[model samples]
Target: MHRNQGLYNYLNEHSWQITEDWYKLVNDEDSESIYSTTDPEIIQSLKEQNQDYFQHLHKLFIEKEEDFFRDFKIWSEELAKDQKHLKTPVQYVVREFMNSQEVYMKYLKEYFSLNKDNVALDQFLSWIDLVRRVVNLSIYIYIEEANRNTLRQLIAQKEIINELSSPVILLRKKIALLPLIGDIDTARAKIILENTLSQCADLRIEDLCIDLSGVAIIDTMVAHEIFHLIQALKLIGVRSTLCGIRPEIAQTAIQLGLDFSHIRTTATLSQALDRIIAD
Candidate 1:
């Protein structure tokens, strides 16, 4: 029989004992591990996952076939995306994999000692290489999946922040209030312009009161974007009224040679509201 086949058969026959001993070692060393928790369901689930991993690992060793490795890769990818695994820290997962590697190596060493007449040095070296390859691939998949999950979360958060920063609250049937607060940068100005125009169209807002009372500073680019937003609103048949234009902002707009004669201005949101009511 082939050396790999002999090793595979030995491991497959003792898979149950290996898994049990591996879990015991991990639990004994890692008391705070999610797998070592007292919850029966969680513990059972972790056992099942470990068993699945071992089954695929055994197949990979026995077959040494491309399809077996492909299936193992797919299974490892799924495990990486698993909610339970994702919740665990990457360090903990990595440590667990390292422990499993140690356990497998110890078991193989024992197996070699018992079957010294049958197991050759080259065969032992081949088995070690296989173990290293599997462990390295598993770690790579885990880290890649974790990075993807983090990136997905960051994108979701950015979308939410963009929406919150450019809110349009409807005060009346045809009037909406867009309160602009904080410093206006070019990027934020673009988001503000796009979201406000889209919301105004969706809400059928004829008059939009843009309150800038909380805004502290504005640059030339930001002032130009504001004017562009007003022009865009006009094209879509929504009249924009600028409210609470602080002295600094007004001075900056003037310094930039921006013409605001076509845009309506108010001292406060209340005055803008009064004008809307009178109209």
Candidate 2:
């Protein structure tokens, strides 16, 4: 059994060489990727980040497996959160990781050829395995973090759309209009309920006209949410009128055993507005 002291020394000494070789072959032509940037600062930052990754990865040759991976996680997270890397398409990032891995493997083979008499075959294979693990773990962590970023953005966008879709436009002093549009799923229905109540309270609305004419579909859950919204408004001392109820929506509301006896109903938004003005 041969100690891999020589392998470790070689990797540490020539780490920068590995980074340079990897950068030379990096495929950065993708228009949508951050790698395609022409800014010299961004290009230099990319090089520094890649070199840092190599700095953490090559320590696997001398450090305990647990310690190596622990440090690698930190590096992977920083890379994942780097604004530039995050903007780069994940597939392109993955391709570059593989390219860097190839560079390391090439260097390892070079080192082996030069010290073939001193390095054992099994030690060489073990080193290969360690290098592969480092690259694989790096890819795994980066992808995981990227997915989390994507999910957060989606949630934020959904919240914004929900807030905009259920806006309470002020018609007059203490009078507001909520014109529901698009299909309403349970999730969106919940947001609508919360936002409508909040906006009405904020505007100190006395009467709210909820128009559903532009709404394409209102499933059982959504119909129930609308009912709850009117009920919630009454609790806040805000009166609500149902307007522009399409025939299908009306049927769905009726079929769901929704009680609207105490609520005011109108055939169109104009009629609802007229009634609000009269009151």
Identify the leading candidate in terms of lDDT.
Answer: 2
Expressed as tens digits, the lDDT of each residue in 1-279 for candidate 2 is 323667778888998888889888876778889778788997888788888888877777778777778878887777778766777789999999999999999998999999889888788898888889889988998899889989999999988988999999998899999999998888888888889889999999999999989988776777678888888999999989999988987887778776777779999989998988888
Best by TM-score: 2
Global lDDT scores for all candidate models: 0.82, 0.86
In candidate 1, what are the lDDT values of residues 1-279, reduced to their tens digit? 223677778888888777777777764335545765777887777777776787778776567456766888988998899877776778888887887888788878888888889888777777777877888899999999988988998999977987898899999898999998887777788889999999999999999999887888777776788888989999999988999988887888788787778889998999998987888
- TM value for model 2: 0.92
Error of 2 at 91 (Å): 0.8
Between which residue pairs do clashes occur in model 1? Answer: none
Clashes of each: 0, 0
RMSD of each: 2.9, 2.0
Per-residue error (Å), model 2, residue 51? 1.1
Model 2, residue 167: distance off in Å is 0.8
